[model samples]
Target chain A: MNTLMRWIGIAVVIFIAAPLVIVVPMSFSTAASLQFPPPGYSWGYYQQFFSDPSWLRPAWNSIYIATMNTLLTMALVVPATFALVRHKFWGKSFANLMMMMPMAVPHIVMAVGYYSYFGELKLVHSKLGVILAHSCLSVPITFLVLSANLKGFDLTLERAARSLGATPGQVFRHITLPILKPGLAISALFAFIQSFDETVVAIFISGRDAETLPRKMFDSIREEADPVIAVISTLLFAVVFAGLIAPSLIKGLRRMAGGTPSK
Target chain B: MSAYLRLAGVNKTFGNFTALGHIDLEVEKGEFVTFLGPSGSGKTTTLMVIAGFEKATRGEITVADQSLAHLAPQERNIGIVFQNYALFPHKTAAENVYFPLQMRKVGKKEGMKKAAEMLDLVGLKGFAHRLPKELSGGQQQRVALARALVFEPDLLLLDEPLGALDKNLREQMQIEIKRIQKRLGVTTIFVTHDQTEAMSMSDRIVVFSNGAIEQAAAPLDIYHRPATRFVADFIGESNLLEATITDAATGKAHSPVLGEVTCGAEGLPPLTDGQAVSLLIRPEHLKLSREPKEGRQNAQMVIETIVNYGDNAVVIGHAGDQQIRVRVPGADVVILKEGDSCHFSWTADAVFVLDK
Candidate 1:
């Protein structure tokens, strides 16, 4: 059947990605040179990563900045996307066009613009400056996902809410927010990844104090050039894997908790 | 209020095309007024205006003598039912019914109590916890009706609420709606293009044509004495006869081929002698006989064709130069056959002079 062939194609893709998982243990190399199926698994590199102030400091900074950037981006993106979806007005197309601009242009191109803009504003090297750059890069993804979720929504609920005597704000808080749960989770997850995995924008905007995890990983590759990069990538791959699997698991649990859809 | 809702000089223009114009209607506190017309006749537009979902370009609307122009749809205290039912797919039948009460800040216990009463009123007592999709078309419509009535709105506007049901269910829902609307006695404005639905349920019907009220009257009057040719043709099956005013000799006008007709319509408008005008005659009103009547002067025509629809018969024939159809009660064994001669006669008052 056609369905079986599609599943076979998916299996082929997973089969292709199988050997790449070997890269995870390569960071344990006891020797100075990088080798796959690491020569001897040792706790030395991980011990170096945990105890040494040098290795731990930038890693902490990168995690904090990316987390903060994701939060800030969601704050702006959620309301902007809601307004775009709910109302009809002049220049609506223009607003949608503007929101999509940063995603369509390459991140490196925007990174150059951000670098010069921040430099002239004297904000370069600050944590806030790097956060601003990351927020900009993640916003398009968040807005697009949230907006698509909102457009197909039945607007009569809002009308019914208003007629019921809820103020517009109460309707938005209670009804709109409840219905938007799935989309919110999806958008927040995507936006977090976009900021956390950003390298090009971080390289251009970050100073020594504002370096993110991906930027630090890039610097580590340049200096030592070993399989430690693979360890970090595998760690990130785990996070992405968690995000991808969580939706289905949560949905399954919800389905089990509830019965089938009633007539 | 004497009249629960009233509209005057209403005009609506979507871009350059006028969707509704110069509409006037008054629905009494407990009366059921229907907007009946074909598609694009502004029935839905008029409903939207009354619901406060649309603004009129120039008009006045008063619900219970309160001006509705500045009020929002929620503030208007009106209930709406759409063609699709618009039930919350996520909410159970009981929960959907209770939505409006919750909006008004009613306590949950009281809201649920009232919602259950409404669900029972609609005869969906045991299926209260089921979602909309779980119900049949008729049950879904009952849910929609329950949701609308639970709020006890000042006016209930139904936009073709029974349109999606099959014929049998649609007929059943018609009676159900009529019973419910009468029981509630809430002012109702029901809109539809289905003339049978309008005739069966409406206290008064407003026939719409091209953004204007063609005729607004009781169902029988609108059918028997339509003010326009459009109304006669639209509301029921009518045979339009292009007849000349051959003589106003008896101090009354005689419409040709329509037997010998006399109207107390003294002025006769400007239709002079030999001027062709349309005469509206309902098909069912034509009395067809095989034998010539003793004292009745009737127009004789040969039966051209007979369509035998079970329970009724449509006898198409040529009367003079005009083709006409006569409907008689004969879905059973029809005595009339093609190529046979038949005599047709109608009462003096049955012929309606169309304003053409």
Candidate 2:
């Protein structure tokens, strides 16, 4: 049974990796149109991706908007998650359901809603509209991650600190915040990635002035099938690969350092 | 005279459940008091009230004539070592100890120096650099003690800090905690459900049951003369007998198991004739013999079971419908076995009468 399970796991990995393998080599292809097994290969698409202002503007817009979305999402979610996880009050279940409601609705449905909503508010093509819309989408995952961490935290540490002459603010600064740093970091990263990779809603509302990278890529794929999309996909894959492997590499190094005999 | 710490008419209720009921206590400076009780007995609730974490529903608490009703826990200047030893996991032992001093705005050099000294006082001289996870259970307990005591707060509260250790380590930490508490002359309240720990470490034991104080007296007084039937059964091994008083002046009581009995009258209240009462006798106070001894109260019982420990054995038997227990030296077990008819005797002073 174990051998069979191991073979199944290997097959699943191959199934997920097959599409990504195609994208990496296709990014270097010199072909102009959408062709899988390209006739030639070069770094021409990479040069075009880096130099063209049309692509560069959307890339910058996505970075700026994602960063703002992360900040706003964390600011709103942290205290709300603490309250929802730690205290009991009336209507708490309803409030929790409301926070997760955006995630329940399909993004295509939200795209239509935001199109009408932002057009009425005259925020249809602005950066602020994209940020506000993305923050709503980011709240559920951020709250879920943060509330799980807050629940696992041992509350006796705060009590001990308070008894040791730490005021409420000092307790939060010294004990609660430091202990929750890693969870906060991961939750903020999730919010940033959620906004940066969002395409459907960005396509409906980001119109022309605040065009996000995903929205621009979607349009480019439909109109001309720009090879630069493959280049961008490869770059994003490399970045995620580095992010995934860095923590374990650092942990292995620490283990080796800790195992050495100390004077 | 005003006491150092006073809790007057302190009552706490959570919704419909009463957690504490009109608790009034006064503690002299430098005295070690143990709140001994089973779970849900308001001992910890009282501690939280004193520590300013739980607000009393009605009354007030004062330490040194200063009302604590409006003060937050951080302003109470009380140190507490929790049952789980809530040491900061991210900080070293020295840093954990220095936290209170840092909060008080002490300079880093002086605070760290004092922290090291406190660590040394708790016998953790070379262990100042290790985190709490790296330390053993007993070592973590010592670091917690050091951190709680480093600032020399006005009061110290320990809530079953030794519950996590094994037998030998628990005993060792008990002595160590008592030594540190005495050396600092800090007014301390230790809460524990273990009666043996209370008996061995406390200057006075306050027994709690059902959110009320059952008895508050010195350790030996609480042991030899429990005020209530709950105290008698909760503190130690006891054989409680239902009896009726025959004479108030002569302290005479009649029980079905032992026909006529004389009880100690030093602290017992006045009793009326034909009043129902409970007679308590400690297990070790009863003497077991093959025959009735001369000049002592004796009763005949059929031995049902004998549990052997290394140094002593408990002999459980029945006299009529009442169960009796007698402690005997291990050497006497060779000549006795289960199912033997034995005579158990005690002096008048050993029997305490409680007018339930």
- Measured by TM-score, the strongest candidate is 2
In terms of DockQ, the best-performing candidate is 2
Chain B structural similarity (TM-score) per candidate: 0.92, 0.98
RMSD each, Å: 4.1, 2.4
Query: What value does the lDDT take at residue B166 in candidate 1?
Result: 95
Would candidate 2 be rated incorrect, acceptable, medium or high by CAPRI criteria?
medium
Native contact share for candidate 2: 0.83
**Residue B243 lDDT, candidate 1, scale 0-100:** 60
Candidate 2 chain A weakest lDDT stretch, 10 residues: A254-263
lDDT of 1 by residue, B137-179 (tens): 7898999899989989999989998889999999999999999
Which runs in model 1 stand beyond 4 Å of their true positions?
A1-12, A15-62, A82-92, A222-228, A254-263, B14-17, B133-136, B249-276, B286-308, B313-323, B328-350
Worst 10 residues of 2 chain B by lDDT: B263-272
- For model 2, chain A alone compared with the true chain A gives a TM-score of 0.94
Residue pairs in clash, model 2: none
Please give, for residues B176-253, the per-residue lDDT of candidate 2 as tens digits.
Answer: 999999999999999999999999999999999998999999999999889999999999999999999999899999
